[model samples]
Target: MNRLRTLLFSILFYGLSVPIVLSVPVSALFGRAAVVRHAHVWALMHRMLYRRVMGIRVRVEGVVPPGTYFFAAKHQAMFETLELQLLLGGPAMVIKRELSKLPFWGWAAMQYGGIVADREASAGALRSMMREAKALKAEGRSILIYPEGTRVSPGEQPPLQSGFAGLYRALGMPVIPVALDTGIVWPKQGAKRPGVVTIRLGEVIPAGLPREHIEARVHAAINTLDRG
Candidate 1:
């Protein structure tokens, strides 16, 4: 039954995404605001589909303060990607360069103001990321990044990628560490389970902290939702 539900939801999700993705070019004709508005609508649709079809509810435990701050979140499942878009009102995301190279979706992401960085490039990637991040900051938009770099199953504690610390120090903004257990209900590769996914926002870690201190705080804060 769960498998059937997952399959049905996946079909509807992607089926709907096709027209939305195709409309990216048309959306761009109207300008960036149009593109962003379309993206937000897409995220909201995914949230509705997840709730109605899969019975997965997303609950926020802590306050998500307003303003142009950095959002460091746990990467446990694809669910958070959509959830954050709705949660933060279309904050700019730091995504892989490869994703930006795709067809329609890639172009739409760029048009919608996503920052793409090459993870394999190490220091060079951080430099590129910092430059793009600064631009987003100038626009008064929040920056969303997964410090661990990739999705990890719940209960796993992977050290944050070095680039995260670099970006944090260079960006010079408060960091809001978001912890979540989305993997419990929405595993990376499996049937979606029906449950409440809690997203807890930790206290803001102010700017100018030492690299070690900031990294430590973010690492711990983002894992608070993981069950032992």
Candidate 2:
């Protein structure tokens, strides 16, 4: 049954994640890049588990651009969080500051060079996020951000949060809008179904566009992957 498969996969996935998460501190000793490479391995392992245990397949469409760029993606389920690190070759993630305050995982994420945002801080958060993002950009790392700020169901489309536009303008990198229907198979907080999740990469939205234009374009591009 779907429920049985989801439960089994969750147990195995987290069971495997124990050693990977614990090894973060050891990886940090080598440097931030080392920690990032370890994170990529973690993500890859989870992807492999998903395929083997849950019968979920990931199919990517469109071109994934090269070089350091900003990635604006739809937030549907936790699956993409694990997939992006593998797909983007250890790109810097835009995550909540609270998540970075955890135990070992938080320490590793900090060393891995994530751009942490204080969601409740509004404008101040955007400023802080951009500052960190710029530093990561200089290191030639792509930035991955979920513009919706949180997971939404597969068919619902929401306007991007304010931080996305701010980062796009301040970072001055081409924005790669990505859309995926992971929620159709992996619901936010329930049993996952067996299916192929398609991730579609939209054409690069050139930098220097007006705020409204950028938001509109990304919003539409991401929703294009929705099933309904």
Candidate 3:
């Protein structure tokens, strides 16, 4: 049954996504606002279909504070990437240089406030990220980043990438660590399990802490749901 649902959802998703992406250029003519809304609708379709067809549900445990913030979230699957854009109202999301270098979708990512950077742990990369982040904040958009930099299996606890700590301190942005249990359902190359995915918005940690302390705090906070 789960496999059937996953197959059905995949079919419907590709059917919807291809045309939606193709329409983005037309959306661009109206302005950035239109493009962003176009992106939102794309995210919405994901949520709608995931719930109705896949029987997967999402539940939040805390209120997301108002105003612009740097949201550091767990990377369990592709689910949170788009869903958070809907939950956070189109924050500028961090993407790797590889993903940003993709074809049309890559160009569209920028229009919707993508901050592209290399995953390298170097001074130059950190400086580049801060530059992109400051520009996004100026646009009145929050920044959403997966500090570990990639998806991990549920219960796997990994140290954050160096870029997160450097970017947080240099940018001086407060952090809102988010924890979610999406991987239990979304993990592996198989059908997605039907279950509730819990997202917890942890207490805000202000900037200026030493890198070790900040990293420790965020590492623990974003893994609140990790059974390991």
lDDT of 1 by residue, 1-228 (tens): 889989999999999999988988888999877888898888888988999999988789888777778899998988888889878767889898889999878888988888877778577777888898898788877889998988899889999888788888888999999999999988878788799999998998999999899999999999998984
Candidate 3: lDDT over CA atoms? 0.87
Spell out the clash pairs found in candidate 2. Answer: none
- Stretches of model 3 off by over 4 angstroms after superposition: none
Per-residue CA lDDT of candidate 3, range 7-76, in tens? 9999998899988888889989998778889999999999999999999899988887777788999998
Q: Total backbone clashes of model 2?
A: 0
Each prediction's TM-score versus the true structure: 0.96, 0.96, 0.95
Comparison by TM-score, 1 against 3, better one: 1
> lDDT of each prediction vs. the true structure?
0.87, 0.88, 0.87
lDDT of 1: 0.87
TM-score of 3: 0.95
Tell me which of candidates 2 and 3 scores higher on TM-score. 2
Predicted structure 1: clash tally: 0
Off by over 4 Å in 1: none
